[model samples]
Target chain A: METTPENTAHGYIRAGDKEKLRHRLRRIEGQVRGIQRMLDEDAYCIDILTQLGSIVAATEKVGLLILKDHMDHCVRHAVERRDEADEKIEEVVSAVERFLRV
Target chain B: METTPENTAHGYIRAGDKEKLRHRLRRIEGQVRGIQRMLDEDAYCIDILTQLGSIVAATEKVGLLILKDHMDHCVRHAVERRDEADEKIEEVVSAVERFLRV
Candidate 1:
């Protein structure tokens, strides 16, 4: 939302992406609640496990979306400006490692 | 709640653990909603990712708890009864692989 390198480095996602991300998160919350309902209803454990995997995968997709946005906008801007590009790249790499479970 | 080898393989979790698992899941739902609010407030992306990481970690913990319960009750019961022990073990291994992201 801000138009400065400092805000970019400080790390907020693009404003346009915010509502979409929030929407995904709301769905994820519903999924979690669904799993709880499954448990209460005595649903099969394997079915619940499958649901859990999907939830995790969905969450990672949201994360990847955010991470991708950063690369597309913030990091790219930093590189174009030649301003703190190294720090930006390093921060993103660390985030990638965390997401990858490395 | 029901007892018989068929019900076990069909995969309902143990009665006692259901409440606890549901409690954990409720907490996770809250966490996911918390992240949504964070986005709405324009929190830092790294902070959001960190929050995402914790949500994944907590969800996996719930999956693990269910898996462990299956191992302790269903699988062990199968082995002790010599009733489809191989199938139970195979099912659990598959679940473990899914959980471990293999």
Candidate 2:
């Protein structure tokens, strides 16, 4: 489906939150570059792996943040709408399950 | 940053692939809802966990697909551009590292 502005407006992510999400993604991008530079300089594998661990942690943080936003906004809105409350609840529950699995 | 059509056009996910990705997400949404119904019916914990594991696997597939698309399109484009090739390469490597961590 086409992602119109109106669609986005009614979706889970708030405008401000989306901006923050993008900022976080950009930072992650930078971190990745830093790791590459380290590799080029023949950095120790353990040190590189440590940085890799940090990146994984940071990425998970971003994912969790988005998941929380989805629950707070998308799932909540679905509950309020009553049109697809069951479906919405299930979606959120499913997301929570997946999140916890990590 | 604002997700303009132009920006998307130049980015990783191709138009056809985006449609497929959305379809997969919708399926995941359905699976999640199904799990909730199972929970309400007092399903076994192991069964529930099994379903949750499926969701995780499916989610990981989606993430991997997107990551591959990023490497093929965005990273490749960046490399061809030669302007920020190092940064782009690193970004992809970081993503791969995170994916493998799971």
Candidate 3:
């Protein structure tokens, strides 16, 4: 189709979900810009490392939020479809491993 | 609602996309299991290192596939919806940074 459906039969987003996600991201954006300024000024190595760690933690939190949504929406939908449930689960597990590869 | 719905109004997956994704994930699963075997028997450091690299690369490929899908579907959908598009872009970029942290 030339245009995405107004709402796919399978869409997952809710009105509130979008708003909440946006707010969280805005905060993260500020954190990231701060990191850039630190880098530009050649901030102390340990200080930079601390900020880096915070960024990583913040990013991981976002990933976890997305993953939770996936479980609630995508995975739940797939399981109800009566096909590929195990495979779908395995896919999520694979994703978690990739996410935790640090 | 307790139900995830027959399809969300925002569903991104198409029939062909599902099949292709499953096949790719299955292969990645096998590779992961193989890595476990290598670890189980105390394989040579170099040999293990090689497989670990392969796993990271394979996982990154999966992430790339996902990002492509997001850009094609989720990002496009968000843009058309006239919502927090910039925030969403920054969110994705933050995700990329976390993914490349290694």
The global Cα lDDT (0 to 1) of model 2 is: 0.56
Report lDDT (Cα) of residue A3, candidate 2.
Answer: 32
Candidate scoring better on lDDT of 2 and 3: 3
Please give the lDDT score for candidate 1: 0.79
| lDDT by residue (tens digit), candidate 3, A42-98 | 999899889888877877777766665665555545555635545555675567557
Superposition TM-score, candidate 1 onto the true structure: 0.83
Q: Supply the TM-score of chain A against the true chain A for every candidate structure.
A: 0.83, 0.78, 0.78
Model 3: how far residue A2 lies from native, Å:
18
Candidate 2 CAPRI category: incorrect
Sort all candidates by TM-score, best to worst: 1, 2, 3
Q: Which candidate ranks first by TM-score, i.e. highest? A: 1
B2-102, model 3: which lDDT tens digit per residue?
A: 33463266556666876877887898889888878988988888987888788777777667666656655654444446466555555655666566562
Give all TM-scores, in the order shown. Answer: 0.83, 0.47, 0.45
Where is the poorest 10-residue window by lDDT in model 3 chain A? A1-10
TM-score of chain B of 3: 0.75
Whole-model lDDT per candidate: 0.79, 0.56, 0.66
Tens digits of lDDT, candidate 1, A1-102: 122445544446766688788888989999999998777666767668878988898898899888888788778988999998998899888877786777
Tens-digit lDDT track of model 1 for B1-102 = 223455544555766678788788988998899888877666666667777887898888889888887788878988999999999899878877886688
